[model samples]
Target chain A: MRINRRRYLTQKVAKILIWMAALSTMGVMALIVLQVLSEGIPVLSPRFFLESPRSMGREGGIFSTIIGTIALTVVAIVVATPLGVGTAIFLGEYTREGRISRVIRFGIGCLAGVPSIIFGLFGFVFFVIYLNMGWSILSGGLALAAMILPTIICTAEEALKAIPYSFREVSYSLGGTKWETVTRAILPNAMPGIFTGIILGVCRSIEETAVVILTAGSSLIIPTSLFSPVRTMSVHFYILAREGISMEMAYGTGAALILLVLFVNIVANWRLNRYIRKRA
Target chain B: MSAIPSSPLKAEVKKLNFYYNLVQALNDVNLPIAEKRITALIGPSGCGKTTYLRCFNRMHDLYPGNRYEGEIILYPDQLNIISPKVDPIEVRMRISMVFQKPNPFPKTVFENVAYGLRVRGEARRNLLEEKVEKALKQAALWEEVKDRIHDLAFNLSGGQQQRLCIARALATNPEILLFDEPTSALDPTATSKIEELIMQLKKEVTIIIVTHNMQQAARVSDYTAFMYLGEIIEFDKTDKVFTHPSIRLTEEYITGRFG
Candidate 1:
């Protein structure tokens, strides 16, 4: 009876400690969100989103930066999705676990751990200087694509692995070729997971400032073409805060960025849940 | 060797050997699959019964380093199904399989049944509907699923899902249907239902089954091959093999003495 009471007391203490840790984590997130939203919400007027900045960002709005962010992100996603997904398929399906596959996986693991600032440096050198792309959306977008490739490949590969091996066998026994099996039996089932990866890539692209600033120049004008230089919202926020240009505008941009990321995550999770429910 | 069946031959496996990398999984196995008849392969666990059954459709080719020796000759054409020259896809086109566990695609019941047809590039809406309906009916699942044909296959009961897999296999009108412990994951009622379906299906296609259940081999198979240690120790009529002693190992396994 004494031992049982001691065990119960220990369990209570452990539970309270864990509960405190979780509550503190939540507390930090709530504080950050509340601080940003309180300062930035009032600045989000219709004109702020519709008009271009003027007088070196001291007046007017940040319409051009929004367009720039969209264009750069579009270029990044369009280039990255196929390449990442294809690489994942090739790695997961075409090759057996051998020395070559192991080496390739090791390379991807190393790439995933590289800092984004290194990506910025590489983009500045290879894309801007060597390729003569100059400071443009194409350069920055390609750099962002490379930054997100490892994330997409790793997630997509995991999703592919989650499918039962029997599904492949069933497809093969039904006379379906490897390509047919992947497209019909495998990809359709893995779509939700793959979409989640893409969503993650989008979030990374939106939040990224270093790579965009170095490769895609901070042009205040909205981009007219893929080759045109433009400023993304995050880059705008970074410059505003760093140069002491406009603290209010920086907070406003930070709020928009947070809201966008949260929205994407929520929508992606909801869709994934629906898909799992339907399959179940 | 036992006397060959009097029925016309659908395929012949002659001195067949199979290897997985350096490991030999099937040794010098030979069997005759009679046309439109059921042949059952019975064995203790790890005796390579499923390995032999997979040879009929070149399933081992999907992986690296697995190799096949000798011939699995399909009758009429006399084509060696296991030859390196024959594409695995071509071999697979003529054969379909039902797995040990029910493996319905994460699709609607209609789509699950229609997958094989779609893979074969059959695109006419009316023809797809007809074939899907016919195959589902042939598998004895059409009546229960007719209304909810559009519903996801995962919603079906375990027995119904297995039947749906059978229907999916049947949709392509394969020349040979391979069953790799198709009913092992099911209950007694489902197992009996699957046995009945297999018996009925032999009128249209040749069948090669790998079963763990001795009673199942006795009930549904026209011919039975008892395998031990990756070798076929006895092959004969199911009744004769079950009732009479051909080899000590066969008798021992049949009488529940030892595997």
Candidate 2:
């Protein structure tokens, strides 16, 4: 295994290229975080959080948008988590070799690849227009749930795959049935990955605006029911930025959106680290 | 040792043929496992010794595309165990297995041993504690692990993990115990310890062990069955099998001429 001069030179080049690619991206993320923090800090106050959405010059807040985003995310989590985890279990445990499983997997891949605006168009026609839901929170949540289902399913499947087969064998040998083994052993072992999947799904859903904008109308008042019109943080930011609002409000809202995304990533990373520690 | 029946031929197999897909893993294998004694199945890799041992309790049924045709008769009762309706779980409960590699459940030492009892609905705190302690003592692991009964089983050395597996098997009070190359993954010291444990355990449970180590078979087993090409070449008392095998293949395998 002696290294020649040519090989050594190539190795050095490869190392530099790898670091360059990694550091460049890391630097961009850090710069974005710093920019958001420096700009958004002055705009955020305890009172701002409590107030409702309103036009500037007249005075306004993001209360309705915040509540709507929370509601949409909660519904999405409930809908996606079970379906995603169950699909993961089926792929990991029951699927050995089959055309159907392959088809299902390819379908998920294509679903994830579909553009958000296209999804918005479909939701706008299917749920909001044809179903006559009339810009409702339920319609928005279901649309977002559809958008993020692929994320949850893929991550959860990987987590289930990461678990050792020996654990399953041990459980079976001890007379644990398939369902018992899945719930007690497989799911517990894959919890970190599953949690990561969920958080990522939530983050992606929250960051999306096109789909929410079409399904959940730009109502400034707080949504009292699922059928009522609502607005999310992303949609609010979009409306504010596009409608020629004061530059300060637009920049501040953008920064707030960035912070929200960062918060979700942090929680997901913590869960992932905890899972890795357990595995180790 | 005193608890085991003195009778010989506790379990018997007849005309057993095991196939993995179209490839035959075992062919018309018949043998008797005596009570209160160790029977070692010795051969090279792919010789079907492990496969044959797995058939005693139908562990082979775990895999798809595997088919077995034969009668396995349990002595005294003369039970025909090859029927598809026979529950593999019940068979496993009565005849426990120690895998080739040490596989302790990812749990505390106490939980690992008590797993078998708990599966059968034995949840009394006092009884569960006593069984865990007794099984550990039987496997000669009590002295090393008694203080850390609550410690994770994965933290132990390979030998300790193997013993813990043995202890887990013993907790079920199986009438027969199967070992599939139990010491192949262990060091010399651990191998010797497991060998000693096997010798001690044979006094109560019928033992059927698979081994690549000829010396281990000679040292611990009462009888040895030599297999090659998925067929038994010779089977007799351990001394006779080593000293004067009936088949040339058996002699060559025993003499380390080929695997």
Candidate 3:
């Protein structure tokens, strides 16, 4: 009876500790969000979203930065998706687990762990200077694409692996060529997973600052073409806060960035759920 | 081997051997498949029945280092199907398979039934619809799934999914249908329904089924090959093998004395 009581007491203590740990994590996230939203929400207005910034962002709005962010992100995603997904398919389907595949996987793992600042440095050297592209969306976008390729490849490969081998067999037994089996049987089922990876790449591209500032140039002007220099919202926020220009605008930019990420995640999850339901 | 079917030969396996890398899976497998008839392979687990069945469409070729020796000669053309010169895709176009599990593609019921036809370049909408309907009816699943034809194949019950696989395999009107334990994953009712469907299908196409259940072979097969340890112990008429055994090993296995 005494031992049982002690055991019950230990269980109660462990439960409380776990609950405390979870509550603290949630508390930290909530506090940060609340702090930013409290200072930022007041600055948001229709003009703030629609008009371009003036006088080094102390006046007017952040319209130019928003366009720059969208353009850079679009370029990054467009370039990255095919290369990443194709690499994943080739790695997962075309080759067996051999020394070459292992080396490639190791290279990808190393790439994933490399710091974002190194990507910025590489982009500044290879694309901005060496290629003489100057400060442009194309250079920054290519840099961002390289940074996110490993993420997309790893996730897409996992999704392809999750599919049953029997699906391939069914396709083959139906007289499908290898390419046909991949397109018809494998790729369709892997779409949701691939989409998730693309979304992650988008999120990373949107918030990235070092690569954009170094290669794309932190110009406040709205970009006219791929070759035009521009500023993204995250870069804008970093400059505002670090240069002691406007903490209010920085907070506002930070809040908008958070909201954008959240919206993208919610829409992606909803679409994925609807697709899964229809298939189920 | 002594009791060859009286029907015309569809394919013949001569001195066939199979290997997964260095591990020999089938050894000296010789059998004759009759046209428009059902031939069932019965054996213990890992006895090479499914491996032997897979050789028909060169499924073993999909993986590296898996090798096939000797010939599987198809009739009329008399071409060696397993030869490196003959494309596996061409052989697969002439033959189709229904797996042990209900492996319906992640597609709608109608699309699942129409996949093989589309693979063969059948595109006209009206033709696809007609052929899909005919295949579904042939598998005896048209009435149950007609209203929900656009619904996902995964929404169907286990038995219904298996039938959909059958319809998918039958869509291209394959000359031979290979079943790798089609009913092993089903309940008794579903099993009986599949058995009935298999028996009925033999009138139109040559069938090579691998089954673990001895009774299933007896009920649906015209000829039965009993395999043990990667070799065929006996190949004879179903009734004769089940009743009047000529080999002691075959008798022991049929009477449930040992595998």
CAPRI-style quality class for the chain A–B interface of candidate 3: high
Is 1 or 2 the stronger prediction by TM-score?
Answer: 1
lDDT of 1 by residue, B1-259 (tens): 5959989999999999999999999999999999999999998999999999999999999888999999999987999999999998998888899999999999999999999999999999999999999999999999999999999999999999999999999999989999999998999999999999999999999999999999999999999999998899999988889999589899999889876
Question: For residues B86-176, could you state the per-residue lDDT of candidate 3 as single tens digits?
Answer: 9999999999999999999989999999888888888999999999999999999999999999999988999999999999999999999
- After superposition, which runs of candidate 3 have C-alpha atoms over 4 Å from their true positions? A1-10
Model 2 spans > 4 angstroms off? A1-5, A56-58, A125-134, A271-280, B1-6, B75-80, B121-124
Q: Clashes in model 1: which pairs?
A: none
lDDT of 2 by residue, B55-145 (tens): 8777666668889898888767777666687777777767788888998866789988987787787889999999999999999999999
Candidate 1 chain A minimal-lDDT segment of 10 residues: A53-62
Model 1 residue A32 distance off true place after TM-score fit, in angstroms:
1.7
Docking class of 1: high
Pairs in clash, predicted candidate 3: none
Better of 1 and 3 by lDDT: 3
**Share of the reference A-B contacts seen in candidate 3:** 0.81
Winning model by lDDT: 3
Tens digits of per-residue lDDT for model 1, A1-280: 9999999999999999999999999999999998988888888888988899887676778899989898888899999999999989999998888898899899889989999988888999999999999999999999999999999999999999998998999999999999999999999989888998999999999999988999999999978999999999999989988999999988888887788789888988998899888776
Question: On TM-score, who's better, 1 or 3?
Answer: 3
Better of 2 and 3 by DockQ: 3
